[model samples]
Target: PVRPLWAAAATAPPAGAEWVWKATNDVLNDLYAVLRFEVQRGPLSRSPSAVSHANQVYPKLMPFLRWWKQQPDRPPLYYATLDVKGAFDSIPHQKLLEVIRPLLREEDGYLKCPYSRWCGKTGKARTVYGVVTKERFGDVEAVRERGRRLGHGRGSFAVFMDLVEYRLLSRTQLLALLTRHICSHV
Candidate 1:
């Protein structure tokens, strides 16, 4: 079951307002980790200029800004800041799923253990354990090589659970809901 936990916002709102945080169960969190990994490795990979981590924002931009300002013929420089802290709340879940579904299905891929033990046959399994070492320490490179051997390792399914106030939905029912519409138009 998903739990809702509320924490104080950084700054209080002018009027009546509250913040609610949705915390997922362990199983859902694990599922999310896998989804996030695949989404990052495959579709929706971040651009080099993107500053996703708070600690990275200054490090990434400061040097560039310094060099640009040093340029004698530099044109007028401008920057913009957007407060997207609450942006997700404005996005509809169904629409969010709709946007994600195509990205997940873009490559029509599946999930397999990175070790390849579960999905691979004898003499067929791909293992990075022996291949990658502390000297190399290049798991990302190894994963890319694995992708060349395998196909694009993108996700084939997207799961969404919208929890109402006091309702609890079992994992089985959710799985059923996920596959329910597959054959309707087939």
Candidate 2:
């Protein structure tokens, strides 16, 4: 959720766009706060046995578990874990657009994920300018190479995740349930 102040300042606001801008700003702030908190908390404990157990019980649970543990105070040693059902894919596209539109400067503005590649579908390659690069589109490998070249120093990854999460998690709530687990002694 790293917005370029210069970009926001340079943009000419549309008529009566204050409400939209304000809402987008709020969402961005929330997303930033959540991510910062998670990173500061660091990764959760994941012993080999525990991971093996999760893998055996639910094959797809490992990824989710890894993601969950990376969140701030996610394990809640003294509280039960809370899972937001269908967290992704529930976010409204319009809301995401509102948050991203101002940040885009070029004519295309938003990054275009062609329908062909929308669902991991592949077809002819296309090119799109993004916050990270300005060049012709090549194959997926080229795109990945460009990304690696850019690295993660400029907050591109954060912006990408923000856009993605905004698309998912429509109605979300956090509930704290007490648990007997404690790790202070460990």
Candidate 3:
């Protein structure tokens, strides 16, 4: 049997949140964990689309560099790196739950059926979220078009884009993203 949820406990005040909530993944439970592994025995791995890590770098970065170098009009290149700080935690609890609720045991196949003959009435979780839509909520060109419609000149948008590009390049990187041909093995 696997526990659906357990209140792990709250955190101390001032330093962290007054009561930080933690969700648990019960993937280690013996019965279903074994079944899950057996079902996936030696198959090709599938990655979660929304989750990414260091392993994705080599395949993308190396190919991109090769393509960029081969380009006839490629500009002076400066490698820039940016990582969203605490990105997952920055997601609203309601938004995260919104993504999860529809995929619960009854709705999604990966989640095991609760019981074979268990046809019972249960309330699906609900949370109210206030959403606001703004104009120009996308790419630089779209934003520039919005500004133009509101009568800001082309120069304004160009300057805005330049500032954005400047800030990205000037931000401190975790590792200096300089190109070097040091092929030493780890």
Candidate 4:
């Protein structure tokens, strides 16, 4: 059983008619604890926060630097890192839940999603919000690198890099650079 904790518009109509669903410890302490545990069992082995590519790439850098050293006149290089502040929030909740649905099929638990019980400031409001369950670490997802299990995933960062590199740098230009820097050195 959940309750609606709402606040009316501070300034004008629809300015901030916010509705917050409150899941008191009394209502969900035991059930959600179990819910969280059941969903997490034997799944999502990939760690989202690990810097795995650094391991593969750092070792290869030795070869690249050695190759670069052999070159007559090397141009300046540019490689920047992107740190998205709300990278976790950018992903849609429903989209991620859809991915997790299949994993839950084998789960033997039967718990109905709790919804808001009270009406909002609006007359007889009935905007029912669901339980809103998620992983203990809400942001962690399979899209992240399987750092614990290196070979498990191709890595989200790697896939994103591939897409960006494909669009920004032409194959011929990359191949020519690699060839001039690597093959000739070999």
Clashing pairs in 3: none
Instruction: Give the Cα error of residue 168 in candidate 3, in Å.
Output: 46
lDDT of 4 at 83: 18
Residue 3 shift from truth in candidate 2, angstroms:
28
The 0-to-1 C-alpha lDDT of every candidate, in the order given, reads 0.39, 0.30, 0.30, 0.33
* Rank order (by TM-score, best first): 1, 3, 4, 2
Q: How well is each residue in 1-186 modelled by candidate 2, as lDDT tens digits? A: 333223233476679553222322232332332232233233432432132223353654556667777898765433222111111234443443343333223232112221111111332222222221123233445444434433343332211212231111111210100011111111
Write one digit per residue (lDDT tens) for candidate 1, span 38-109: 455653246444454567778777887888889999998865332122223455445544543443332323
* Global CA lDDT computed for model 1: 0.39
Cα shift from native, residue 48, model 3 (Å): 14
Tens-place lDDT digits, model 3, residues 1-186: 333344556546577335545434222232222223222332312422211346766775677678778999989976532222221234554453343332222211221111111112331221111111122223556444433333332322212222332111111120111101011100
Question: What TM-score, over all chains together, does every model reach?
Answer: 0.34, 0.18, 0.21, 0.20
How big is the positional error of residue 81 in model 3, measured in Å on the Cα after superposition? 15
Q: Report how far residue 26 has shifted in candidate 2, in Å.
A: 7.4
Off by over 4 Å in 3: 1-52, 65-88, 100-108, 111-186
Question: How well does model 3 score by local distance difference test?
Answer: 0.30
Which ten-residue region of model 1 has the weakest summed lDDT? 157-166
Q: Name the best candidate (by lDDT).
A: 1
